[model samples]
Target: MEVQLEQNEKKGKAFIDKDGKTLAEMTFSMAGTKQLIIDHTEVSDELRGMGAGRQLLQKIVDMAREESLKIIPLCPYAKSVFDKDDSIQDVLRQ
Candidate 1:
């Protein structure tokens, strides 16, 4: 299994496997000056528990960090993922 992260403009997505076989994905819109609102996060059931979600989130986080963007996880999955994670909390709204 392979995962890939791709982004365009102010939108970002994490795609797993080629041929559009997405295992987990996240969508977000930029809000200028290192700030963004995460709209959604989805992980295929079959891919769940395999760390795919974390991989996807990591990719998104890396992108955000590289672009110096803060994040507001509006999606439940995203929020929950971060709730227990301290590593990515620096990018979250305080």
Candidate 2:
């Protein structure tokens, strides 16, 4: 299976798909020069507990690192995911 993710700026959406079917979607807004406020993350009911959230989050983190930005997770789910992820602590806003 091949998964693809892309930013849809018009809709303020991040789409995650596997073989053309969307598995998850995340919506976010820019908070500032280096901060992003993730509004929500929703995974397909059938895809829940399948690690798709982790994959989407890792992609978000990678994008933030590449752009030299700090993340301010406003969504509870996002906050929870990063709370125990020490690897990304360095890029989190203090």
Candidate 3:
């Protein structure tokens, strides 16, 4: 499945799968002008071990790079990814 992103001013979500069934999803809330607080991440049982959660985080990281925004990974999953990847330090909120 391909990850897709949707966002407005206050919030955003990265998700995947077809039809109305969401195979996985990660959500974030806007913080001030240049940061996003990742608050939630979920992957369906059938999609587990498929790296769907990582895919969503990667998409969010790409979006953050494109928009020049920092990430405050409040969600444990997201924070773990950020902690393990040094390359994402540029966009990590200090």
Candidate 4:
């Protein structure tokens, strides 16, 4: 599944769509140009336990790195993922 992105002005999301239905997504707000405020994440029942949340997080993480930006994981799930994973911490905003 490919992660798609949609953004307008202040907010945006990294999402996966399967046959026109969203399977998973991570939403965020643009914090100026140097930071991203990741505020929420959700996965469909079909994607539960399949790492869909992480997948969406990774997509945003990669975007952050590419843009030389940091991420503040305000969402509980996103914060939990950032807490457990040391490898992705480079893009995290402390």
Candidate 5:
């Protein structure tokens, strides 16, 4: 599977798939100047148990680190992942 990222100044998405079908996606919007609010995440049934959701979130986290931004995980899935991963705290909104 491949993950593709698309973003501008105000919003962004991480999408993953195989063979032209979407497997999962995570979306977020900018909050103020230095933060991002992760608002939604979805994994297709066909991709369940494949860690695609985690991959999407990781892509978002990687982008945040690269851009020197923090993340507020408003999406439950993202929140849970952030809560469990202490290593990502560097870019997590308090």
Candidate 6:
């Protein structure tokens, strides 16, 4: 599955679309130039248990790394992932 990303000055999302419907999404807002505040994550039943949510989050994490930004995972799913993954801590906001 391919993940897509869209962002503006204040907020953004990484998501997957299938046949004109969204299957998974992770939403976040920009805090200044250095922080991305993850606020929500969801996956459709078809994509549940298939790591769709993690794929969307991974897109955001990749962007954070390229842009030199920090991620503040306010959403429960995102927070849990960050808490468990030591390898991705480089982009996590402490």
Relative to the true structure, how large is the alpha-carbon lDDT of every model? 0.78, 0.73, 0.94, 0.92, 0.91, 0.95
**Candidate ranking (lDDT, best to worst):** 6, 3, 4, 5, 1, 2
Candidate 1 structure lDDT: 0.78
lDDT of 6: 0.95
lDDT of 3 by residue, 1-94 (tens): 8999999989999999778788899999999988999999999998999899999999999999999999999999999998998988899988
- TM-score for all predictions? 0.83, 0.81, 0.95, 0.94, 0.93, 0.98
Kindly list the per-residue Cα lDDT of model 2 for residues 1-94, writing each as its tens digit.
2334455442255667766687797676767667776778989987898887777777777777897877778888889988988998877778
Mark the 10 consecutive residues where model 6 has the least summed lDDT: 49-58
In model 5, residue pairs whose N, Cα or C atoms come closer than 3 Å (at least 3 residues apart or on different chains), thus clashing, are none
Candidate 1 structure, TM-score to reference? 0.83
Question: In model 6, which runs have C-alpha deviations exceeding 4 angstroms?
Answer: none
- Model 2: what TM-score? 0.81
| Residues 12-65 of candidate 5: C-alpha lDDT, one tens digit per residue | 899986787777899999999899999999999988898888889888889889
lDDT of 1 by residue, 20-85 (tens): 566677777777767878888778888888887777778778877887778888988889989999
**lDDT per residue (tens digit) for residues 1-94 in model 4:** 7898888878999999999999899999999989989999999999899888998999999988888999999999999999999999999987
Q: Which residue pairs collide, candidate 4? A: none
In model 6, residue pairs whose N, Cα or C atoms come closer than 3 Å (at least 3 residues apart or on different chains), thus clashing, are none
Across 1-94, the per-residue lDDT of candidate 6 in tens digits comes to 9999999999999999999999899999999999989999999999999999889989999999999999999999999999999989999988
Error of 1 at 26 (Å): 1.3
- With a 3 Å backbone cut-off (N, CA, C), the pairs that clash in candidate 3 are none
Winner on lDDT between 4 and 6 is 6
On the 0 to 100 scale, the lDDT of residue 67 in model 4 is: 84
Best by lDDT: 6
Ten contiguous residues minimizing lDDT sum, candidate 1 = 14-23
The pairs that clash in candidate 2 are: none
| lDDT preference between candidates 1 and 2, better one | 1
